[model samples]
Target chain A: MSKHSIIISNISKSYGNIKAVDDISLNVKKGELFGLIGSDGAGKTTLLRILTTLLLSDSGNAQIENFDVKNNYKNIRQIVGYMPGRFSLYEDLSVEENLNFFASIFNTTVAQNYDLIKDVYSYIEPFKKRRAGQLSGGMKQKLALSCALIHKPKVLFLDEPTTGVDAVSRKEFWGMLKNLQKKDITIMVSTPYMDEAGLCDRISLMQNGKFMETDTPENIINKFQKQIYSIKSKNKQKLIKDLRKYKQTYSANIFGQAIHYIDKRNNIKIDELKNHLKSENHIDIEIKAVKPNIEDCFIELMKKEQSAVTNQLKN
Target chain B: MIPIIFIMPVVQLVILVYAANLEMKEINIIVINNDYGSLSRQLTDKFSSSPFFNVSFGNSHKEANSLMKKDKADIIMTIPHNFEKKLIKEKSADIQLLFNAVNGTKAAVAAGYCKNIIFNFNKDIIVNSPKLILEPINYKRINIINQFWYNPQLDYKIYMSTGILVILITIVSLFLSSMNLVREKEIGTIEQINVTPIKKFHFIAGKLIPFLIIALFELAFGLIIAKLLFNLPMSGSLLLLFVVAAIYLIAMLGLGLFISTVTETQQQAMFIAFFFYLVFIMMSGIFTPAESMPEWAQKINYINPVAWFMRVIRMILLKGSGFAQIKNEIFILTGYSITVLSLAVWRYRKTG
Candidate 1:
């Protein structure tokens, strides 16, 4: 068996003139929890569909657990379980019936793989008699996870599984994933929420059909390469506008109630920034150096990629 | 859904059988009397006494023509002046008959009825007139007695019911099967199924078998109604009918699967299916004879599955034909089923 559960090399897919998945490649080791973090239209779903053998890439190739996605798609289909972004279960069928149906299609019974999905399945077992369409959004997510895990697949592909789920349900869903990884099943999940990036062992920050960075969340943040300051004032909207107008501002964006600002130079003087904001009729100005998170690192990488493209165009 | 499947066929069968009548009756005729002679009055009374004609009197030929122009009359018969004198002196008299030819079939039938009435009146005159009896050297008369085969009464409902039953089966199986796969596409469940390890043949069979059984059940239900309400005959073996129906349904269901594969939505599938249904039903000879169509249309009916079954079912049920009688149609249907099903399977794709 190969050490890597998934090996994608220079896979490219295009829809007419628009490239949905540009030439992209990555490797996910067995038993590792990998995340593809990006906003909508970043080609995350397209890449996952290629790896699951549901779609063909226009160029390059991909493999799931050493089975070629092109020639050995049958073998790949037998080993991988996919949950699409939409609720695709038989809505008229009950929860237990839906799970049983998926399990039977995979040539296994629910009792055969009961232990694999016990943690997730147990959460919705009490409401198993209710129709799938009648279940709450969070309950539906749990049932979907149970169905995906019912066959004890070697690799599970979840495409935005928690997108419309509630916050508490999203957290619980992630917790369920952590448990599944302990059983040696390689998990590849995609989400638009940056806060969920920390849960994965490794993640690829994607934009415009290409990956900007692929590394551990902590390492990506460590490579921010500049000091980021969080500044708060009485007028947050005015503070953001004033910070963008400053000559030394590298980038100014609103993060919650404060503005995360970066400077053009290596070191920035906090009193100088406070005095600049005060001059603009700001009050209760507070500026402090704060450690960068995944969102901060993502913004910085995206900005760098944008500048690189413009420079290439000029050349 | 189950109730609708069972109820719709019965409703369509009853309503269509009762409403679609091909037999023509009650032709309206206008008679213009130019002579007040006894012979002319006798001819006018002969037309009014028959069950087929609704008779009305007119003063002049112009009045009858105007009535026909207003669509108030179907045929106009004008008796000429000196009608009795010409018949007595010259041994012949002219009676002019004009017909409204807007509906060609109705006009032709009405003209035939008029000819029969006139022929009978001539026979009465020859037998009753002492002068004609003495003068005639001989009269050789031949009459034809019609014995309608299979349907002695020539009830239009019996013929229409069988054709409607074939159509009912076609609609249920073809429309349902065509919409089945496209529905999954609409609901986004096809993507989930495509990722599974299920084989294409298995998937296609799973979709076909259930509808095939339901269609067969519908056929049985429609047959019961036909027998009870229309007194339709079932002279052929029920088993043979079902076997042939199974083969015919495979062809129809295959066509539907082909439509489903080509279309992306239920609405699109419905439109395409309806187009085929219209062409198939019209060309199937259900409402009209396939043999009487233009030569090119007759050639097109060779590829029409419904046309094949329509001819076969009538032969078996009405004519009590055996396997040897309908073997040619069965062979064609078997080949059609294989070709259409293979095409559908070939067109189905698991991955883009």
Candidate 2:
């Protein structure tokens, strides 16, 4: 039977009085590609830290590959690889030197684990002589991945691995992650880019140290409980405010090229909404029912949480 | 078998034990003897026989003074005229003693030696020529008393080693702390490390081991240099010195780790480490005695790990003091090492 690569139960961590990860719980199956999707500071890094055995929770506990995170961290560290949110590498060491150093730290040599990092390392091989501090964003990211995977860890944790990289580089990185997944390396990646969520086997949408939902990306999109419509007008600024005043409007937020609004008047037709907006001093009105994706799911989840808090306060 | 971890430390202890004690082996002295008589020759013999000083005869007082200012000489003695005639006429005489004040303690000792010779000379002259003092011309004179404490002469090498060791360790600790974290950052391997099956302590220890080796070597080199140049005595047990140094490194590395946790940029980490290094070095009592500090400043020494380490190293090296003599400093260092390390790990967990 395959071992559960990572398991966390009600793990909690705080800095002073602020709860960075509040009673969060989840599991990453032996070979699943798990993702924690959220905006920045959504407790993604905190949760990853605990699971990786680099952090001990204030309460609760976790185990990686059947080893207790607190007691068996050494064993866990040997088997897992982590790429933190920020680029942390020896600025003075050359690219090849860094790889050798980390590989040696794990009691392995680069030649032994050469196959694991061969793909990534090949891309940065031309720049191996360059000091790590001098590498470009994309090249540095590749070299960092090469070092992290040099030990051939059973599981990999990448925290916002694509942040600040160019679009082409982002696409290339995701492609590399896909190939690594084929190696049966259990991967947990955190990213602010919601579009990447669909590429994962499962995702947990997080906000303010809480997980709004945890499920497959397709399921999250399918289970979005609101009918979302995109509306655009000549005066977008005023159009958003006017749409909020409507008694039937449940939620309104700006998304891409339109003001996405969910309405309580589910029976109303699209043409009627357009004509109503035109009558209300909104020009060049266009309205359409758009298919909700992961982004739509996130907005709906946040609105629900906020309304719940407001109602509790009133009570 | 002695553990490899401790081999370097043992070597360091032996080197530093001899390195950190100074007993002023050679004092530079010049003779300005205007008394060209048998008495002048006798006085020069006394100085030449004493291994404590190297005498340069027939030099002018002003020339000798200039050598002292240039750091070439440490003492100058001027004998006034009427040297042999003073004894014949039974008149009082005085010899002028001058010393370099760069180290007030060493200067004071040289002056005390001059006083003792004069005192013994007066006694000898009176005993041999009893009738010469019948008029009771026990002519008024002066006496000066002085004492030197544990390293009483303010040995320069001893003074310098203690201070230099603190600075060296600070640099070592800072380097180690940043190295452990920044390695992951640079390799793009932090993400992989964060996913590792190994525990955090294992990861932290694995990173620290190599730097610890390098630092222990640095400590050894400093000690060896001190011993070869200054034949200072080795007073403390090797076991005790290593134990104290181990504890002190913990505190230093903890501080370095704490700095790494708060800084995103390695450049920023270096600046923060430098600031703390400067603060600890300035307060460690390597250059000045803690007894001379104000009460508030003295109280602060309780918290400064560098000061405690300096105290422990000097006490062990100079006084050859055992753990019993330095128990308070040992306890303080032990507490600091534990507290700082735990706090650093906690902060790292919070920020990681």
Candidate 3:
């Protein structure tokens, strides 16, 4: 019924002197499973909180389903379901009691919305008698989502929902979100997992409290302009330093078994890199061109921002 | 197997009942006697003979009352001028006795003891005074029957136990509700709820209602103990007491709710609660009589919901007072209950 389920415009939030969320704007299309991909302190949460109407923006505004986050917050609340980054249900209450209590608050019976949370509910329904405090982390995550979904909101804003969850639970939660999107419920989920970016219809690559770029996961990865290659040697640290000194090298950062280096090396080949590595006191040198993934794009964004900051400081 | 959680309340009850006594056996009283006549001497001798009475005043009852205000004397006894001539002439005489009634029960006991001595001394003189000189005199004897409405024997333990138990239940339950939510903020579960379509009022009411029911169970437990173990009479309507308790509990729970919303840590909320708890319990008339407190202290009682509740519980449970009898107290407590609850609801976190 709406073109954009959520619209954020020039939103800014400052915690003391630090701008947690700088002036940023984004639109979530109808039924789009959007992802806020950022590391810690990238202001992913501040953005989610602003869109969810939990924290007010210092300037600018956001809307969920034609409801202004500031002016029509009550209506926005009814339309949107927010699963905060934390497990916030009543831990002292039994699982069933917590569900019942939340259902009561919305003036709806649990029976009425059983279908909405049925998927998540089934995993935890057997443990309904268990005190929420005693539940394992995955179970708590599921229960928190079930409670949030009890009202069947139109827009779902999850602030890093899968941050601490196990791999299996994280996979299952995203699977559930995929199904929920079929119902045309716009889902906005935030996560630090670079691998999770592929699961979203669109992903925003962010670093240092700003969005580096926003596009389909494939397009963003496609536009990684530089060729990336991994070169590992006995002295990998020394290899990384030698690679950075190359004038044609665009970026170089150590990644697990090797250094993920991107370069504008026009005529240079892998053999040339290996020969140069050996000449620079490196041993057991191996270089292989590797596909650039989301992490590579994230590092590139961070480097671009860092160089810009350094350049401005010099000026 | 023994239940460990039940032990908490039971142990608290024991510690509270023993420490809640307001009675002071070592009361300091100052006497300023200017009249050295036979009457004054007899009056002094009579007071000095009683264990409850003591003479410590330097000047007069006025000075003693001032000293009492400044925590000097607990009580003061004054002797008027020419007290022997008035007694010999067979005329009724009076001596002023000033009491520091801030600590009601103690003050009431000391004042009554002093009055009894004066009355007895008067009767002795009226009977022994010259019969020939007086034209056939007959003296009247007065009888006083003291009755306690809810707690008839004036037992401090039962009175304090019932009132304090109610307070403990409401406070514990309310604190649990508040802390439950605050813990989420600490642990990060609240973010899930914040993004949900759940209404703000629903969240607050949902959190509050469970604790309210728990507090009700405790209230019933307290009333049962008051009726059976303590043998406190339930003369008025049980339904009335039940309704009144419910109303007063709303105020108590509201206080806890407000505390939870204003504070971040469970410890901070508890500290704020305990601070108010100290003031309310002391001024609630459980250990002291509201009637005997100073004008300013009495003014505070008007706003204190517990003070009003003690009167209702005693009237309904002890005196069996009807609506017409306790209508004023019921209205006041109900108002306090509603105001506190509304304030709690208003302050509850709606956006965050």
Candidate with best DockQ:
1
TM-score of each: 0.96, 0.62, 0.77
- Candidates 1 and 3: which is better by lDDT? 1
Q: For residues A1-315, what per-residue lDDT tens digits would candidate 3 score against the true structure?
A: 559888888988899999988888988899999998998899998888888888889998888998998999878877777787777887889999989977876778899999888988899999999999999988988888888777788888887889888999999989989988887789999889999999999999877667899999999999988778888889877787888998778778988878998777655577776777778888877778788999999888888888999999999
Candidate 3 matches the true fold with a TM-score of 0.77
Give the number of the best model, judged by TM-score: 1
TM-score of chain A of each: 0.99, 0.95, 0.94
Candidates ranked, most accurate by TM-score first = 1, 3, 2
User: Against the unseen true structure, what C-alpha lDDT does each candidate score?
Assistant: 0.92, 0.78, 0.78
Instruction: Please provide, for model 2 over B64-129, each residue's C-alpha lDDT reduced to its tens digit, 9 standing for 90 to 100.
Output: 777877898887888888866876675666677778878887888777776666667666666565
Clashes of each: 0, 37, 19
Per-residue lDDT tens digits for candidate 1, residues B1-352, read 9899878878998998888878766778988878778788878889989998999988877888888899999998889889877887777799999999999988998898889998888877777876553455444656689999999999989899999999999998899999999999999888989999998999999999999999999999999999999999999888899999999999999999999999999999999999999999999999889999999999999999999999989998999999999999999999999999999999989997
User: How many Å off is the CA of B266 in candidate 1?
Assistant: 1.2
i-RMS, every candidate? 0.7, 5.0, 2.7
